[model samples]
Target: MIRKELLSKCKEALTTRQSELIKQVQDHFGMKYEFAKETSGELSNYDNHPADTGTELFEREKDLALNEHAEKELEEINEALHAIEEGTYGICKICGADIPNERLVAVPTTDTCVEHAKNETFNRGRPIEEEVFSPNINPDEVTDEEQVGYDAEDAWQEVSRYGTSETPSDFYGDKEHYNDMFPNSDENVGSVEDLENFLAADIHGKFIGVAPNHDKHEE
Candidate 1:
């Protein structure tokens, strides 16, 4: 149970970091307010000009930015701690691999190993952890006429508008097979547009819609 012990230590370290970050946030804000108060008081005297006000502003701004980022890390760490407690901590969100200890030490909130983690690129304003499994679930690749909400009425409408009403019957081959199956009505090149045209027409016929632009034409 070395993983368990490391996980606990990692949680403790993160909690300590969270506490430290909160104190730093408070101290930085206090420093800024105190400086501002002093500057305002001196300005009220009408002749007092601080020599390093610009430098102070620059330093304060940078420190404020850093503290905010640290605070955000604390948020992720808290989430990670909860996940650990819930016994859902080490499983990779993408490939279901056991996350390595080194990675846990480096980024305890992470839910994926390096390989799967590489597939997921995202930006964080602070220390980061990512969960890349949910929206990208199995068959996140399902792209079809049915997925785009297209029915025969829509195909009928497109054919009636651009080509011929008879084209729908000829294009789809028969109405009975596809009257319930629907058609692709993507705003741009649709599923129907791909298999029906292009150099890969024969390939598409053999593979339904695996034409060159199958993904592009996916509704």
Candidate 2:
């Protein structure tokens, strides 16, 4: 049971917080309106660079997010005020215990005590979208047979096509051109088939004969 004086104090605090949140909500809405007007007044077209449009879009999204957060906070403050009138202000919603006076003073709108406030901190479960777009296959577990479809080497080659730190000067083997600088310049360098391993001709106009696969011969 809460003392009359303590209850009155809690009510006053909740009321003051509610008023402040109401003002914040109003300011956020006003700001949002102004931002919308400003965005509408600006010109956007294919003539403008994509980066400029992206920056504008980012700012608009940030303003929208801020307004949404303020509105949610205002809702929480209003709920706290209602709870105070119902004589359930200082009680923890999760556990049937009296929330500490200090905690109440610090966070006036919280319905749960610190010990029971899991949702207020970390989100507990994996997102639903993970079920649809699953995580990548672990590289260590990929089999040799799976390399043809999609493997670590394919992923590396795809990324390396853009650029890499190592140049022709860094290549250990004889690199006549920049293209020959990549690791595994010979023997199934990019193609999936084993026949592609020996398919190459020398620059001297001499026939570089296909060497028989010793591995196949051993089998």
Candidate 3:
């Protein structure tokens, strides 16, 4: 059962918050109007190019977002106050269980208990890309014997070749070139055997010959 004293306090808190939110919305609009009038100079934004009033447009959008947030919270507070009058303030909307006193005190505008509350992080779970992407392998977690032939780390190394934040000083040994800053910089890529680097067969597999500069690769 919800205590009479706590209910009274919750009502007082909600009323105070309601007034503050109203003032906040009014103040936001008043400032937004003043800013727009001062920056725009003209009667309408229709005359101005979108790019010309970039800063003013951005500020107006920001103010609108803030006002919307305040109005939404004010709406919640109003609903909570109405629920208090109906003697259902502390009950969870989903489960009908009495919300904990601590939770109620912390979030007086809340209609549901902690467990039943809509949590985006909990509901969303992991990233969707992980389902189809290559398996991410940590070098520290895997030994040489257990390592896969190619994994997400290898993919990263391939991409990192173009550019990375690492510097020559970040590496352990001497790194004279920018290209040598990445991990396993000297390792071969796209080929398993040394001969594969210089040998290739035609599409028909009828002509097998050594490629040019095969001696340099052999050395």
Candidate number achieving the greatest TM-score relative to the actual structure: 2
Looking at model 3, the pairs that clash are none
lDDT of 1: 0.60
For each candidate, give its TM-score against the true structure. Answer: 0.44, 0.53, 0.52
After superposition, candidate 2 runs with Cα above 4 Å error: 3-9, 27-40, 120-219
Ranking by TM-score: 2, 3, 1
135-159: candidate 3 lDDT, tens digit per residue: 4455534464365476656677777
Lowest lDDT 10-mer window, candidate 2? 210-219
**Full-model lDDT, candidate 3:** 0.78
Candidate 3 positional error at 174, Å: 2.8
Better candidate number, 1 or 3, judged by TM-score: 3
Question: Which ten-residue region of model 1 has the weakest summed lDDT?
Answer: 130-139
Q: Rate the local accuracy (lDDT) of all candidates.
A: 0.60, 0.68, 0.78
Q: How many clashing residue pairs appear in each of the predictions shown? A: 0, 0, 0
Which residue segments of model 1 deviate by more than 4 Å? 31-35, 38-41, 44-51, 118-219
lDDT of 2: 0.68
